[model samples]
Target: MKNHIVTAFRLTIVMLAVVGIYLLIVYGGSKILPTKGNAEIITQNGQKFYANIGQEFKSEKYFHGRPSSVNYNAAGSGGSNKGPSNQEYLEIVQKRIDTLKMEHPGMENTKVPVELVTASGSGLDPDISEEGALYQVKKIAEVRHLSEEKLKELIKNQAEKPFLGILGPSKVNVLKLNIALDQLK
Candidate 1:
C-alpha cells in the first residue's frame, strides 16, 4: 500500500511538471508569431477590422469570403451542424447558388465554387479558395466598372500559393483582396 501511494505521488508530480513545461513552451512560442498570439488587426478607411476573423461583405463591388454559419460572429464561432443531405442545409445552399447566378448572369453555365455556398467549420474562415475568388470576377468588374482581366490579375497577385509549393490548395484572403481592389486606381 505504501509503495503504491509513493508511485502515485511521483506520477502526479511528473504530470504537473510536464504540463507546466508545455504551457511555458506554448506561451513562449506565441510571442514569436507576427501578431504575438493576438488577432491580426487591419485598419481600412479609418476603421479597424480583425483580419484573422471573417467579415461580411454584402456589396457587389467586393469579393466575398466563405459563408459564415454564425454570421461572422467572432464570439460564437461554429458551423451549422447540418449534414450534407439535411433538407434545411440543402435549401440554404440552393438559395446561395440562386443568388450567385442572379448576381453573375453569364455564370449560369459555369459551376459555382462550393466554398462560396458553404460555411466553414470554424464559421470564421477569412480566406476563400482561388477558384471561389475567380468565380465572382464578372459581377465585381461590372459593378466596379473595372476590366475583368485586371481583376483576374489582382486575384492572381493576391493568391497565396500552397505551402512549400505542394501542400494545401491555393487561397485568397478576401479582406486583403478587397483592400487591394480599393487601392487600384
Candidate 2:
C-alpha cells in the first residue's frame, strides 16, 4: 500500500514538471519575440505558419510574393489539392501569367519564375525559389525606382543557400526579401 502511494506521488510530480516546462517555453519565447500582425497580410497568422507576412507587407520597396492561393476564409492554409496536370491548375496558371504580363508589361514570358505560375504544394508557402527572386528583379527595380543592379544585389544578399550546399535547391525567403525591398524603397 505504501509503495503504491509513493509511485502515484512520483507520477504526479513528473507530470507537473513536464507541464510547467512546456508552459515556461511557450510564455518565455513569446515574450522574447512578440508576434504581431500589421498591414499587407489580408489574413492573420498564428503559431502554425512560422512565416510572418504582416511585417513584410508593410514595406513596399521589395519584390512582391506570389499570389497562388485563394482562401475563402483563411481558416488554415491548404493546397488547392489539384494535381500538376489538372485542367483547373492549367487554367489558374494561365490567369496568373496574364496578370504577370500586365503587371510587368515589358517582361518576356521566359523571365517569369516557375513559382509565380505554379501554386506551392501547401499553397501557403512563405518562400519562393531563387529563380522567382531573379524573375522579379526588373519589376522591383522599376516599381521602387531603383536600379536593376541594386535590386539584384538585394536579392542575392537576402536569398538563402541550399541546405548543406546542394542537398536541395537554393530558395529565397519571400518575407525577408520583401522586407529588404521595402528598406531599399
Judged by TM-score, which candidate is best?
Answer: 1
Candidate 1, 71-150: lDDT as tens digits: 89999899989998899999999999999898888999999999999999999999998899999999999998999999
Which parts of model 1 are misplaced by more than 4 Å? 1-7, 17-37
Per-candidate Cα lDDT values, in order, are: 0.93, 0.66
Compared with the true structure, the alpha-carbon lDDT of candidate 2 equals 0.66
Per-candidate total of colliding backbone pairs: 0, 4
Q: Locate the minimum summed-lDDT window of 10 residues in model 2.
A: 34-43
Checking candidate 2 for backbone clashes, the offending pairs are 61-181, 61-182, 62-181, 62-182
**Per-candidate RMSD, Å:** 2.4, 7.8
Find the number of clashing residue pairs for candidate 1: 0
